[model samples]
Target: MTVSPLVWTLTVALILGMLVYDFVFHARKPHVPTMRESAIWSAAYVGIALVFGLVVLALWGGDFAGQYYAGYITEKALSVDNLFVFLIILATFRVPRQYQEEVLLFGIAFSLIARTGLIFVGAGLINQFAWVFYIFAVILLATAGSTLKEALKGDEEEEGDSRFIKLIRRIFHTSDEYDGNKLFTHLNGRRVMTPMLLVMIAIGGTDLLFALDSIPAIFGLTQEVYLVFTAVAFSLLGLKQLYFLIDGLLDRLIYLSYGLSAILGFIAVKLFLHALHENNLPFINGGEHVTVFEITTSLSLSVIIGILVVTVLASLYSPRGRAMSVVSATEMLSERYLQLPADATDSQRDAISRKLARQLQRMPRISDSLKDELISDRRHYMELLHEVHGEHLDYLSARQSSDDTSSAESAELERRKTAFSDIVNPAAESVGSAEESVGSTAPEGSSEGRPQHH
Candidate 1:
């Protein structure tokens, strides 16, 4: 159904108005928003979108607008799912709370450009070949099935050193710490990249992978390039804020992908039917021509809402929405710490252990089994005792005894950090200090890879 020219003009005006409000009122600062502030802004954005949908219903007779809104809602769902990985990346970076805004802003902007390009590619596919819809359907179906697999298994922690990342690390010089958002730094007449730059590439590269799932899913919604582009564009417009607002809620949305897959499967079938209706081909008799699919705006809206509700409810009610057994090693270390030399006060021992645990947790090589056991694991307790002793040797040992042979090792780490700094990542303790890193204990058993987390 065609809408009046006046309605289109009004919709454009509304879209521009929201952009103005966002720029003027919401995005004045590059700072992290508090929970209350994030909650209010998120609600306001959703309300604005909802109000626009209602206006679409009233003015355009709910036909074209319905499809647009459903597509927007679905795209928004996929964008939220993107945030799940964003959280992991952010936490891994240990980005200072204040600097996260910059990382997120950069990420959102990059994703918008990337997804817009994806939308056009998707539109081209469906337009060029009718059978492309089935390919998209199968892609969506496989991605949807992956949801069940993902739900059943936890994501394995990938090592930071990917081959590409390693090659880049070898190829560039980098800074030791963040140089206040500069992607690269130079020291002693040698140019170096920072962790920030590598992180940015990692994030952009990762988002490109995520787009594989999302582009297909949104295509399942609407084949019209304009509708698909606008819907995806608008859904992503507020994503940086959405990341902070729903950061905590994401862990609770454990079944989120399943919900997304279900919606995509629904939309895939809808688009396929729409394709069949418009097909001029005769060779494929399986294609049934129907003028209109029953998929209206309301039904699409219901599916989106139902998926969110069920996802949230399932996560909330999940019996194992927890680490099978988990506790911060820091806390446990503080609890059982005994003062050396027997007469030391409790406060001193606790302080020492807390400081040491913080230093240790920043190291990545701890076996998860040992990590999961906390202070309760006798083996882990023994390792800590050796590490404390190792720290002493590290401080007193001769500068000549150990190799600092190449400043290249330091240079390489700088390059990795510089390269990755644009994306927030977990803090990495310096590894050049062999004592802090290689502090080893006589193992009760063969300790290799990651000790099994039980």
Candidate 2:
């Protein structure tokens, strides 16, 4: 169905208005959303999406509505996969918990803008060339294969070491520390890019890459530009809240990659069939359309939902999934503890330590069932946890004492800090030490001799 210019204009305005409202009312203040807040807002966005779908059904007929739902569901599932990378990026940067909301909102907004451009480009390609479907089919098929391979290998690519991020770092003078939500800050009497900006760039770049696959996958479901644009926009609208709601549970969905692979592979077949049905290449079938099987939108939606349901249920019930969740939770809590600022309150420290301790207590029960590699990793992190716990105790003791610490106590504290830093980020620690050594050897009055605060 062709959409009118006025309808398109209104739709774009509504999406942009919602984004503005979200930023002004919700994300303007940097704060970690409570679980209840995340849930409520997430459901609200979903409800709005569903209500809009019903409006489509009333005006555009059931066929168009089915296409919209299928496209929306596919895009939403792909967005969940995107979150895995987002979680890694945030953790790698050690973004402050309260300020994560701002970063996520920026990422979401960037994703919408980036994907909207790609969607139009894809539509243009489809309009101008019938052979584009074949290309899209191949892309989806290859992506599915690679996704499955990674799932089988049980390895995730480190987003922190991406070449794009490396290029950005090499091109810009970046400060290691974040200056609140600001992208640039004054450091050493000069302005420098902050980690906050780097992370936002990282997320935005990753979102562009994610769009390459997701756009093709959604187009395979429906070629209508209106449905594609609205589906994708609504899919991303609630993504930030969804991230918070499911962040802790993400690791438990061990079969997610497998399910995504299956979904993409199914969509690939659909696109291939559609390509054959609209064949225009002279080399194949003498440039004539072939009457082959076509997958209906309703069938696509049903299959996608079925696969997701089964995937979630299997992951939740599997023994290994439980073990992996425990390990992941332990690692997350440990990193959060280490990432806490020097001025963190005692209650903040106590909360994380208590959670880490509980995760540690659960580890022994699952240790016998874990693979050797995981067991080794767990052991390594366990040592780090013990050290962190010891440091916490020392900090509490120091706070309790009203007198100044002796040289020995101060040295001991420094040693523990170095040890923790080495365990968590050895490369960074080594680099910092090298810089410190260079500074120590420099002349006293030289700017190079002044220690830089990270």
Which candidate number has the best lDDT?
A: 2
**Per-model CA lDDT versus the true structure:** 0.59, 0.81
Tens digits of per-residue lDDT for model 2, 1-454: 9788999999999999988988998888888788899999999999999999998999899999999999998899999999999988987887888888888889889999988899999999999999999999999999999999999988876785588888988988889998888999999998899999888888888888899999999999999999999999999999999999998889889899999999999999999999999999999999999999899989999999999999988988887887777777777776677667789897888777667666555655564436443444533453444445445555655654536777677666566444433343332222134443333332211233222222
lDDT of 1 by residue, 47-85 (tens): 777676676567556665777787888888888877777
Q: Give the TM-score of candidate 1.
A: 0.65
Error in Å for residue 343 of model 2: 5.6
Worst 10 residues of 2 by lDDT: 444-453
For candidate 1, what is the lDDT? 0.59
- In model 1, where do residues sit more than 4 Å from their true spots? 1-30, 156-161, 280-282, 286-294, 322-454
After superposition, the stretches of candidate 2 with alpha carbons farther than 4 Å from their true spots are 341-358, 367-376, 391-454
Estimated TM-score per prediction? 0.65, 0.84
What C-alpha RMSD separates each model from the true structure?
A: 12.8, 8.5
